[model samples]
Target chain A: MSALGSIVPLAFGALRRNRMRSSLTSLGVIIGVGALIVTVSSGEGSKAVLQAQLATLGTNLLIILPGSSTSGGARGGPGSGKPLTHADLLDLVAGVSAARYSAPVDRTTTQVVIDNQNWLTTVYGSTPEFFAIRDWTLARGRFFTSGEADSGAKVCLLGQTVATQLFGNGDPLGQVVRVKIMPCEVVGVLGGKGQSSQGQDQDDLVVMPWVTFKSRMMSQDRVHVGSILISALSPDEVSHAQSQAMGVLRQAHRLSDKELDDFTVRNLADLAATQEQAADTQTGMLRNVAAVSLLVGGIGIMNIMLVSVTERTREIGIRLAIGASENRVLLQFLVEAIVLSAAGGLVGIALGLGGSLALSAINHWPFIVSPGWVLMAFGLSMGIGVVFGFYPARKAARMNPIDALRFE
Target chain B: MSGEPLIDLKAVTRTYLTGAATVHALINVTLTIAPGELVAIMGPSGSGKSTLLNVLGCLDQPTSGSYRFEGREVATLTRAERAALRLSAFGFVFQGFQLIARTDALDNVELPLVYADVPGPERRTRAMDALARVGLVGREHHTPAQLSGGQQQRVAIARALVNRPRLILADEPTGALDTRTSIEVLGLLQSLNHGGITVVVVTHEPDIALYASRRLVVRDGRVISDDRQRAHDAAADLQALPQKAA
Candidate 1:
């Protein structure tokens, strides 16, 4: 037989003789590799979910909220300062050349009743441009037009949750639902958006004209809009649009150079980028932990191999005395160590993939199988075998045949 | 019996440091062996007969000596070259049989050929042939643990013969066997030696030395006697033993 061909079977036979030791020695490798796979796949899966959630926030969109208001020395959060006004929104749309569409938004939570069914949901006041900027599509009927909005029409769009709660399977397109005291006709049902990245249900709201909302449902003045939503002409112009809108809003608010503007222009892209950076940092920490476990697994293999060499000293003597060269004995033991570790790697990969599959299924995330990482993990395990198995194999090879044969 | 001596050792010595004292294992041993001869080396415990066999088989290097195999100086060989020489020209049979525990008789016999880089099919064929030569045909697949003491020794002898070495070095070949089994093993060695292979056996038992045509008695790290005589026929001795209950 070829030298390596023969040596390999000899190695296998020796390992088979001590099956329990072989398996236990490889357990560390299995757990390390499995952990690596789980961490990486989950990291990728969560990243994908985040990207999808960010996409739902609309492309190249920006939100303009009133700056925080300090009341009794306690600073209230954003959207509590001098409220955005209709005049400021008009000035921003006219002055910001990068802006594609702009709409005013006011939101409040109230109960709506229809027939014998009553459900509580947030109601939003917005112009027709709001639907375009949100990229929202109607699953049924149609959205209210700008003319209807200007005439202060009592037409409204129902979010998926509101539609389902109020109408069940029945058609609600022409049904009139009582919003607080005003009965408003449901013009459309918004498409289901599942959940936001923060796990909040996005499909649970009602939309109507800003004039109708301020005049009827809300106890607020008609002059102030709560917030303004804007979309840039393209993705590349989002930053330019943000800066332009900020400059225009500062001028419209009549703020001096030394004073802070009474508004905040936030880019959705920037928020998504920050969230992505946080996820990446978490994934990097997890990867380092997995790497350390793999290193520990390698040390475990080395320990067992050293013990195996000592236990098989007599076997080494027999081989050497039987005309086997030092290299031959070394190759035999080296092959044994490699086979043990590589076998562990294979089982670990299977375990990691299975664990990833179960976790993704449970969490409703995509099962992303990165072939590159799997191959890298396998190669690294084999490298661990070679690196850790060398010392013991060399020790076996360097033994004097006489002393070795006589080793008790 | 030969053009040049098959083995020639001049003033060979081997020493070791136990802890504080230097001990000589072999002291200025001079010896020669010819082809087609069966030589027995007799000694008490720690008398260095095994050391002599090791030096003859090229398993160890002499401390300060001129030792030659055929015509090549032994000290001139590199470690790998010496290993290659052992693989090609020498076969060792130890008293313990030294058959790998879990391996079958056939694989045990094929080990020397494996180290010699012989290809698979031929190695198996040669191993089977060697097993048959040692009268171990039906027990080819039996592991060392499954075989009797005589059968294990026969398997070791088959391993020694598989490489078709010109010289066979057996250290206390019958040390671990009963008289009947030892006789059977000795009969196998006798037949191989008669096939023109030179054989050297180290033994503490004087009865075992009677089977060789030449005997050298070692004492206190030196050879005390060397004599040539008519060898007892081990095949006849095996035939004379009474049949035991199966």
Candidate 2:
């Protein structure tokens, strides 16, 4: 027979003779590889979920929030300052060339009651342009007209959660609901938007005209708007739109270059970039952890191979005495170790795929099956076998034939 | 020696150092065996008969000596070269049979040819032929564990002869067998010797030494007595036993 072909059988025979021990040694590799696949796949899946969540935040959209407020020598948080103004919104929309649409927003947390069914939700104050800027679509009825928004009409749209909680499959259109003691006609029901990246429910709010919100509900002043939502001309122009809007607001607020503006410009693109970077960092750490576990598994293979070499000292001697070269004996043991780890790698891949499937199912994330990761993990296991098995194989090959033959 | 010696050792000395003490395993021993000779080396536990066999078979190197095999100075050969020489020219049989366990008899016999890099078909055919010569033709598929001690030794002998080496070095080939099994194993070796292969056996038993054409008694790491005799043919002895199974 060919030299390798013959040696392979001898290695397999030795392993078969110690079946339980060989399997136990391979078990470490299986767990390592399985965990690696699960970690990477789940990481990829979560990243996809994050992207999906970001997409819902609206494409190429920028949000302007009051930067920070200082009261009594104490600086408040970013959104707690100056509360963006209506004139600031008008100047930004007119001055920023890349700005496609802009809308002022104000919100209040209150209970809405209809036919004794009351639900707590955020009542948002915005214009018809708010729906366009936020990319919000109606599942039923229609959004308020610009005239209704300008004329301080008592018309509102219910988010999916509010609609479900107040209407319960009943038609919400034309129904008047008491939103904090002010009865308003439900003009539309917002489509379900699922959850945001921050794990907040995005569809638990009510929308109404900013004029009506100021007149009937809460109004701090005629000049102050809680926030402003602006859409860019396209996703590619988002950064340009952000800088243009920032410069326009700075000029309108009459803040000098040396002074910090009392407003913050937040873009969906920026949030997505930061979230993606964070996910990549987490995925990298997880990959390192998996690699370490695989390393430990390789050490296990090395340990067992050393033990096998010691246990089969006499067999090695016999082979050596029978004219097998030192390299032949070394190759035999090395092949045995590789076979063990490769087999374990295969099993681990199957287990890892199963784990990813479980994770995707439980988390409701996309099932991401990356073939590259599987091949890499399998290749790594094989490499582990070679790297860890070498020392023991060399020891076996370098054994003195006479001493080995004489060994009990 | 009547003809050119197949193995010639000149002033062969093998020494071992253990914890600051020197033990001369084989001390300045010169020995030669010509073609087609059956020689037995007899020695007590530490007389170094096995060491001499190891040096003769090219399994080991002499500490300070010249070992010539087939007129080639083998003492200067590298480890790989000595292994190649052993593969092409000599076969070894140990007391433990040393047939890889869990392997069939045919595969055990094919081990040497594997190192020789023979093609699969020819290795199997030659291994079968060697097994047939050892009279274990029908037991080719039986593992060493399934075979009796005599059968296992026969498999080992088949393995030794599969390469068709010019010399056979057997160290206590029958040491682990019963009297009848030992006789059968010796009979197989004697028949191979009769087929014109040079055979060297190392053993302490006088009864086992009776099958050799020449006997060398080793004492204190040196050959004290060398005697030539008409060898008792083990095959003939086996035939004389009425209950002979092989």
Candidate 3:
């Protein structure tokens, strides 16, 4: 170990004497490692942002839509049955063991008009429990009470985008907006949620009480629900919630064990997981690209080291003649290569992390610092140093000292 | 003054095969070098003076022959063992001075000890002592390029002496210097020999051969003449020359 330790300074001195050449030789490794770090950080950031948006939808949340119907061998897909009734929503809320918050939903696209300006937007109808299930918070006023919902009051909540479009700088609270010829008072404005994972604006819908929607806006008055939003008490209870909800729905539709139910329950967790898997594939592809770049960088190091060995033949000869062993000569050149690449690796990491932080700040994504990735990249760079430095080092070690001494 | 032989060679021959032609660089020749002798081997270019120096320095092995240092045969040692022997027992100098460029003289002198795994403090002390012995007391920090030709040669001699080896092999030590610098370098070597280290120098210059106590002339792979003489005093010669401004 002491013998190996002594070669370090000699190696560093040799490299330090050729500063520009050493740095240029390491440039390929720098860019390779830097690109690797950026790819990993950005990939991690994107995943974090996706998970956060999923959190807003509430962990283990589920949505139920009316199931398909088969009429004379013509089978329609889901959302084709008789629209779900208010009684079904109430039964599911009361019967499902793991279900925490359940609310009936109804929605339509219509023009929301203020005094002179009008905009086409989605309007939704649900009980107050919809806010709890969807984890939505109000920005200005309160959500309508249960009494207001049961009495079919004309009060409505304005999403941030709709409020901004209709009221602009004016206070949207207590202002009546016309929706399909009916004037509804805006009781509150929803908080901004930015964009969804699909890049759609989340704050673009207006919401009203279910009873008001059934009585005035909906074309049919059979107390039918377009869909139902439900969330489990906890993430672990999602599967249990799904099975219980399915049983209650099947029984309510008067279906036997062999008969298909008239409702479909979709687990949002599974959807999020599938999207995460897709992101993982993308991350894997980026990593492969990084590995290829590292390989190219390693080749660059090998090429330069070979040239250096050729250039320093006389030096090698001198050291050998002065009692340096074959291994000592090998270690000197190998360590020089390692120091070059390690310096490049560290500089690349610093630059990559800074670039990642700036990007996250500009794009409003979460900044993730993964020490494990940094270590792996550094280890890989060192490994490249060893692997690439070996052939040239061996060539120098194998040289005959007498011939090397005589080399011009 | 002769004691037990420090180096013994028996019919050592070195042959080189290049493109199906065998060049006999050295023929079978027996020689013994005793301790405390400054010997010069003189031959023209391609007359194999270098080949003889390399064999003596353990930098090359004779194609066929027996070489013994003290009493141990050299042909039986492994490459690593031979290297270790060279590290601990032999020091070498070359026509080029062979000091690593861009490295300070102190570090250049410390090279052998570094390979020998000597501790840093002791290595530094011994290297400094060796530099002082070569009359380069305050030039430890000077690189080869920063030093004059004679100074650079002194640094190389310091590196050779830093290990305190039994033998020093120098091939054309004064080849790159002018007459004055060459005398200065030869004076340093003479001083080292007076201190009881065995010094073997290979050169073609009769001026350098005159400084040694013994000379072996090589021609056509054969030692044609061996003569002993009273060694010239290089220091007295340096003193006789006119002094330059310091």
Query: Best candidate, lDDT-wise?
Result: 1
Q: What is the lDDT of candidate 3?
A: 0.88
Off by over 4 Å in 1: A70-74
Candidate 3 Cα deviation (angstroms), residue A340: 0.5
Docking class of 1: medium
List clashing residue pairs in candidate 2.
none
**Candidate order by lDDT, highest to lowest?**
1, 2, 3
Q: How well is candidate 3 docked (DockQ)?
A: 0.74
Residue-level error in angstroms, candidate 2, position A64:
1.0
Expressed as tens digits, the lDDT of each residue in B1-246 for candidate 1 is: 548999989999999788999889999999989988899999999999988888898888888888999878995576677788888898888988888888899998988988989999999999999999988889999999999988999999999989999999999999999998888888888898999899999999999999999999999889999999899999898778898878
lDDT of 1 at B217: 97
Stretches of candidate 2 off by over 4 Å are A78-81, A219-221, B1-3, B241-246
User: Candidate 2, after superposition: displacement of residue A48 in Å?
Assistant: 1.2
What TM-score results for chain B in every one of the models? Answer: 0.97, 0.96, 0.97
Q: What does candidate 3's lDDT look like per residue over A108-168, in tens digits?
A: 8999999898989998988998988888898999999999998889999988999899888
When 1 and 2 are scored with lDDT, the better candidate is 1
